[model samples]
Every structure is written in C-alpha cells, then in structure tokens.
Target: MRYIFFFFFVLLTLSGCNKHEEPSSNLIVSSFKLPPKNESAASSDAKDEMAAPASPEIPQKIIKEASLRFETDNLEDTFNRIQSAVTLNKATIQNDSEGKDYNNIYRNLTIRVPSQNFDAFINAISKGVSYFERKDISSQNVTEQYIDLTSRLNTKRKLEERYLQILQKATKISEILEIEKQISTIREEIEAKQGQLKYLESRVSESTVTIEFYKTIAQKEGVKTSYGSKIWAAIQSGFYSLSEFLISIISVWPFIIVFCIFAYFIRKRFKRKKK
Candidate 1:
C-alpha cells in the first residue's frame, strides 16, 4: 500500500515540473513568433495608406500620348502657332528638329503637356490644320500596376521591420550578418519598386505629343528649248557616247588585239584552202 502511494506522489511531482518547464519555453518561442499571415495581409495598407488609394472608383491612373503629322503651307508659321499654343497651355517643348526631304521642307517637335490639358493642347494646335497625314493617339491604364507596386513595397517594408526587430534580439554574429543581408536585399527591392512607382506617376501626370509639319514644293513649268539648243545637246550626247565607247575599248585593248589576230589567221587559212 505504501509503495503504491509513493509511485502516485512521484508521478504527480514529475508532471507538475514538466508543465511548468514547457510553459516557460513555449512563452519564449511565442514571444519571438511572427504574426499570423492573415493579420499581415489584412494590415497591408494599415501601415501605409498610400499602399491603396482611398477611393476605389476615382483617381484612375492613365497615361496619354499622341503623334501628329500634317502638311503645312509655311513651316515658320506652323512652328509659331504651335509655340503660341504651348505657351497658352503651359506646355514644354522637349525637342525641335528641322530638315528637308526630296522636295519637302519639314519641322518636327516633341512636346510634353499636363494630362489635364492633353485634349486642350491638341485642340489648340488643330485650329488651322485641315488634315492629318498621320495621327496616332493612345492611352494606357496603370492603376492596377501602381496599386500592385505600392502594396508590394509596403509589404517588403514591413518584413524588413520584422527582421530588424529580430536582429535586435539576435546574439550570434552569424545571425546578425544573415539578417543584415536579408535587410539589404529587401532595401534594394524597395528602391526598385519606388523607381517603378515614380516612373508610372510621371507618365500618368504628363502627356507626350509629337508633331511633324511639312511643305511640298510645287513643280515649275518647263521652258521651251530652241532648235539650235536641241541640236547642240544631241551633238554633245553623241560625243560623250563615242568617248565612253573608246574608253571601254582601251580598257580591253589586249583582248581586242588577240581576237583580231586570230580572225586574220583564220581568214588567210580559208583563202588558201579555197585557192
């Protein structure tokens, strides 16, 4: 009976010790444990409101661009008109090129205007324009891409923060080095995302316009040629042809001599056979 009571007491003591020890270790692990994945996802935008835009419907990101090519009577006048429109709309001229092709005089311009004034600037430039030789206008939607990048950047930042927290608690040099490497990688990724976001914002804010204006030269009426002038031109053409033929013959003089000699010998042989 005593032995049975002793065994029961010993088992109880060991169970109590285990319960106490397990809880302490579990608490330490839980303290260092990361938050639940669901929580992390839900709080994606909580840390940074810029991750997602406030309004769901408004403020869509759109990039606009246009290309215009047309014929103009006067290049200077067309350039001046575009300049006036650019000034009126607070637009900027990025590039200006002027050159002539065949019988056409052309001027090309690249302009950047605010998104709000995209259509207004186009209309302003179209005042005296009758037709467009080539006109291309396009718009791209980047709302989803912006949102995606913003969200990803925010998430990476949060992860970096977590790693930093763990770094603070880290005691080993190896652990510190590894965590810092991860932080560095995350920072690079963050910078890349930031660059992408800025590019998108720039495109969405300003619209690009390319204008090409050209003038065609009309053909002049041909003058009547006098009879004497026609005779002189014909004589010159014949002289030039004769000179070219002589030059060609001179170039192959050795071959021509050989062919003539062979022909003479064959003629002599034929005459002797006939006799």
Candidate 2:
C-alpha cells in the first residue's frame, strides 16, 4: 500500500511539472520567434497595393501641322492680309521672312494656332490667296505614346516612394546607400517622363501652319526705244572688258618679266654660238 501511494504521487508531480513547462516553452517561442512566411508575404502584398496608384484617364492626343504655298499679285499686300488673318484667328507668327530676289518678291511665315481654330485659320489663309501651288496637311497621333509615358511615370513614382519608405526603415549603412541610389534613379526617370509628357501635351494643344507666297514684277509694254542708252551701255561694257584684261596682265607682271629676261639671255647665247 505504501509503494502504490508513492508511485501515484510521483506520477502526479511529473505531470504537473510537464504542464507548467509546456506553457513556458510556448511563451518563449511566441516572444522571440519571427512572423510566419505567409504573414510576411501578406504584408508585402499590402505594401505593393499601397505603392501602386491609379492614373488619370486622358482622351485622344493629336498633333496637327499644315503647309501652304501660293502665288499673289502683290507680295506686300498679301503679307499684310496674312498677318491680319493670323491676328483675327488668335494665332501667333512663330517665324516670318520677306525678301526680293531679282524681280520677284516672296514671303514665308510659320504660324501657331490653337487646335480648335486650325481649320478656320487655314480657310482664312486660302481665301486670301488666289491659287495654291502646294497645300499639305498632316496629323500625328500621340495618344498611345502619351498613355505609355503616363504609365511609366506613375510606376517610377511608386517605386521611388517605396524606396523612400525602405530607406527610412533601413538600419545598416550599406542598405541605406543602396536604397538612396535606387531612389535617385527613380526620381530622375520620373522627371524625364514628366518632361516628355509636357512636350507631348504642348504639341497636341497647338497646331502649326506654314505659308509661302510670292509675286513677280510685271514688264511694261509700249516703252519708248532708246538707241542712245544702248550705245552708252555698249561703250561701258567695252571699257569694263579692257579694264579686266589690264588687271589680268598686271597680276602676272612678275612672272612675265622673269620670262622676258630668260628669253633675252637664250637669244644672246644662240647668237654668240652662230657667230
């Protein structure tokens, strides 16, 4: 009876100790253990969701340009008309040139107008001219390119934000340096994308038109004949030709003198040999 009681007491004591120790081991593990793989994965997924932001919706992007060439009776008058048309259409003359070549006068103009007024401005120009030598209209669709740039910009911005966050949390110097480098690269890319987007937007909003017009001087009929003027012109031409010939001779005077001296010596030597 004594042995049985001792065995029962020992077994109970061992069981109680095991139970108490099990809880302690569990507490230790819970305090010091890292998070599970699934939990870490979930956190990363959540961060990604926060980093990637949505982009705004933009409509079609189109760049329009035109070229026009025409002839006019009076170039100066046509130029003034073109300037007035540009002003009336609320456009700007980006470039302009006017010059006379021989008896013909020509003017060239490059204008920029709002996309909305492009067609109206073109019509006004056409109305001012009598006939067109060349007329060309061109359109470039940049919608896809614009959208692609926007997407890339958004992605780079998100990446930069992520790197900033990581930089803040980084404890090691090496880790911070790497994160900063990545952030700088992402920032530069973002700025480049922004510049491209702005340029594209500007091109899409404004339209370009080029105009070239010219006039030729007309010859007058029934002019009185002038024999005296023709005779004077002939005399002047003859004098000019004589002057040019004299100048050519003067330019080679040194060479001519040397040749003459050489010829005299050679003739003297030949005469002495004959004697």
Candidate 3:
C-alpha cells in the first residue's frame, strides 16, 4: 500500500509538470506567431522621412542706387569722358539731356549698370572729378519681399490647381462656374505677382546712377564790346525797327486803300456843293 501511494504521488507530480510545460511551450509558439510587418513598415517610414530633401536656401536680393552732381571745367569734354567710362564699364545710358542757361552749361545723365560693377563704374567716373555738389548712395534689401512673393505665387498656383481639380469633379453648373471664377481670379493675381517679381529682380540685378554735371561761365571773361561796335549795333537795331514798321503798314494795305477812296468821295461832294 505504501509503494502504491508513493507511485501515485510521483504520477501526480509528473502530471503537474506536464501541465505547466505545455502552456510555456504554447506561449513560446504564440510569441513567434506575432507579425514583424508592423516594425518593418515603421522602419521604412522612418527611412523615407530621413531621406527626404530639405528646402533650398534663398539668394540675397538688393537694389542699389546713386545720385551725383559735379562741377566740370568743360561740359562737352566731361560728357564725352563719361560716355567713354560707361562704355568701358558696360553700362547703359537710359536718359541724357544737355542744356545751356545764361551763364552755365549743364548735362543730366541717367545710367544703369550691373550691380557687381556699380562701385567700379562710380569710381571710374569719379577719377577726374575734383568735387561733387551732391552725392547720394542708397541700398534696399528686397530678399524678404522676394521670398514672400515667391511663396505667395506658389500658394496661388496650388490653389488654382485645386480649383481645376474641383472643376473637373463638379457636376452642377453653379459649382463649375464658381470654380472657374476662382481660378480666373487666382490667375490674375499670379500674373500680377509675377510681374512685380520680375521688376524687383531687374532692380536687384542692375544699379541706377544718376548724374548731373555742369560748367559755369565767368562774367568777367565775357566778350568786351568796343565803342565803334556799339554804334554799329545801334544803327542795325534802328534799321531793323524801321523795317518792322514798314512791314506792319504793308500788312494793312487793303484797309488803307478803302479809307483813301472814302476820303476822295467826300472831297468831291464838298467841291460839287461849293460850285
């Protein structure tokens, strides 16, 4: 009976161990069955995000301008020299004007040159200049404005694209018309922005230099007149006045002839009455 009981206890112990071992084995199998696809997908997404390119840096934009006034000894010579300097610096003359006052000769020039050569061109023209009456240099930073325009243009284009897509999918006439109207408005805005951007780019790429140069005449150096020359001039002036008076009389010849005829008729009538 004791041996039987001991054997029975040993069998119970073995059954308990089997029960515990079975579940652990099943747990191991279940753990292996969990899918690795989720982890792989997450890793792939991370790689894609990391591999994406970043936005490019924006270039700097600046507009430059200058104004200068100079006094020159010789107007024509200085103008020619300025022209030569412009040609050497690959600049363009946008406007040019020359005039003479009572005692001074002056020239105004508006020149445009590449921004990169702005300083050099200015220096080149300043070489022979002894003094400047006025000098002004200005710079405007347009990078922020440029970037803002670019971003707005991009946004407008995207909005236009979205409108087009909506138009394609629209079934009602009202919806289609509304989409078209929105697209038109967006397109107009885009064009205006584009034009503004182009203008800004042009200003940034080229620098403006306005120049006003003049030469003065000395009063003491004026031509001196002799007495004989003055007398001759007076005689010429009197003769010119007499000629002008004669011309005025000739211009009224028809009226003068009519008046003479009326006077003769009156005198004839008076003689008839006396007879």
Candidate 4:
C-alpha cells in the first residue's frame, strides 16, 4: 500500500513540472492575472512571465512631407515674403538657386516649415505669384519611415535608460564599459533623428517659388568681326599646328634613329658582301 502511494506522488510531480515548462517562443502580449493577494507565489509567477522576453517593445510613428511648386513674376518681393514666411513659421531655407534658361530666369527656392502650417503657408505663397505657370503639389507619405524611426528611437532610448541604470547598478568594470558603449551608440542615433526632424521642419515651412523672369526679345545689333582679330586668330591656329608638328617629331626621334641605324648597318653589310 505504501509503494502504491509513493508511485502516485511521483507521477503527480512529473505532470506538474511539464505544466510549468513554457515553450521557447512564447509571445504573450497581455499580462497574466493572479488569483488573490494571499497567493504571492502566483503573483511571482505572473511577474516572471512578463520578464521572459529579451527584446523591449518598440513604439511606431509615421513621418511624412508635402511638396509644392509655384512660379511668379514679382521675383524680388516674392523672395522677401518667402524669407519672412520661413522666419515666421520657425523654419529655414534649404536651397535657393536660379534656373538655366537665358530667356527666362527662374529662381528655385526650397523652404522647410512645420507640419501644422503646411497648407496655410502653401496657400499664402500661391497668392503672391502673378501667373501660376505650373503648380505641382504632392504629399510624400512616409508612414513606414516614421514608424521605423519611432521604433528605433524608442528602442535606443530604452537601451540608453537601461545602460544608465546599469552604470549605476553595475559592480564589474567590464559591464560598465559595455553599458557606456551602448549609451554612446544610442545618443548618436538620437542626435541623427533630431537633425533629420529639423531638416524636414525647415523644408515644410517655406513653399518653393521657382520665379522665372521672361525677357521680351529685342532686335540685337550684330557687330562685325575685325580683320586684325581674324588675322590674329589665324596666326594663333598656325602657330598651334606648327608646335604640334614639332612635338610629334620630338616624340618619335628615338624610333627614327633606331630605323636609320638599321638601314646603315644593312647598307654596310651589302657593300662588304659585294666586295
């Protein structure tokens, strides 16, 4: 009877161990609940369940931009207004250049503004242009990019915090060095993200004003080329050709000398044979 009782107890213990053992890839999103405050062991079990994952949860956010193109007649005034609007919007100018086309001088301007004032600033800029040659406007939806950056930023921040915590709690010198290295990488990533955000803000604030100045065609008086100038050009060309010929002769002198020597030796050999 005692043997039977011992065997049953062993079987029960084996079954309990199997129940407690979790799978290698357990993805538990929600927290496990405890029975009661008195069940401290159960609460500890729930806490252990939460702390099993090696990686921290990353939060996602989407970053996007809107592009605008406008043409204007009042180049000077429009440029001034654009600069002012950029200042007011707390943004910066990214690019400002003149377009290539002699007949029509076009100014291409890029401004970075805040996301909130995107539509308003665009509308304000549109009002300034005399004639809208071509207005091409579109939104670059960076949903994935934003989400990825947010996730990475969140992860890095968490890592930095954890490293800081480790720096305080760490006892070993090796562990402290490792934590510091991680902190450095995280800080770099944070700074890079900040720069990216700043750049985006500057671009969004000011609308691109490609001011093309169209000049009316006037009858151009043609000046005849002077006889002396034509003569000088011809002389210069002749001098260049003469120099090129001299350079070519100088370059092939070694080959020419070798050929001459060979011919002389053949002539001497033939004379000696005839004699």
Highest TM-score model number: 3
lDDT per residue as tens, model 4, 12-33: 9999877776542243523555
Q: How many backbone clashes does every candidate have? A: 0, 0, 0, 8
94: Cα error in model 2, Å: 1.2
Model 2: weakest 10-residue lDDT segment is 218-227
Best by lDDT: 1
Estimate candidate 3's alpha-carbon lDDT, on a 0 to 1 scale.
Answer: 0.87
User: Residue 48's C-alpha lDDT in candidate 3?
Assistant: 50
Off by over 4 Å in 1: 1-58, 221-275
- Lowest lDDT sum, 10 consecutive residues, model 3, at 34-43
Residues 28-121 of candidate 3 have per-residue lDDT tens digits of 8888654236534534444454347576888889899999999999888898899998998899999999898998989999999999999998
What does candidate 2's lDDT look like per residue over 1-275, in tens digits? 99999999999999999999999999988888553365346445555664577746678898999999988887778888888888888999999888888767788899999898899999888887767889999999999998778766765666666568878899999999888887788788888999999998988899999988988765442123456678888999999999999999999999999999999999999999999
lDDT of 1 by residue, 18-104 (tens): 999998998898889465576365356455555356645647999999999999998888899999999999999999998988778
Q: Rate the local accuracy (lDDT) of all candidates.
A: 0.88, 0.83, 0.87, 0.63
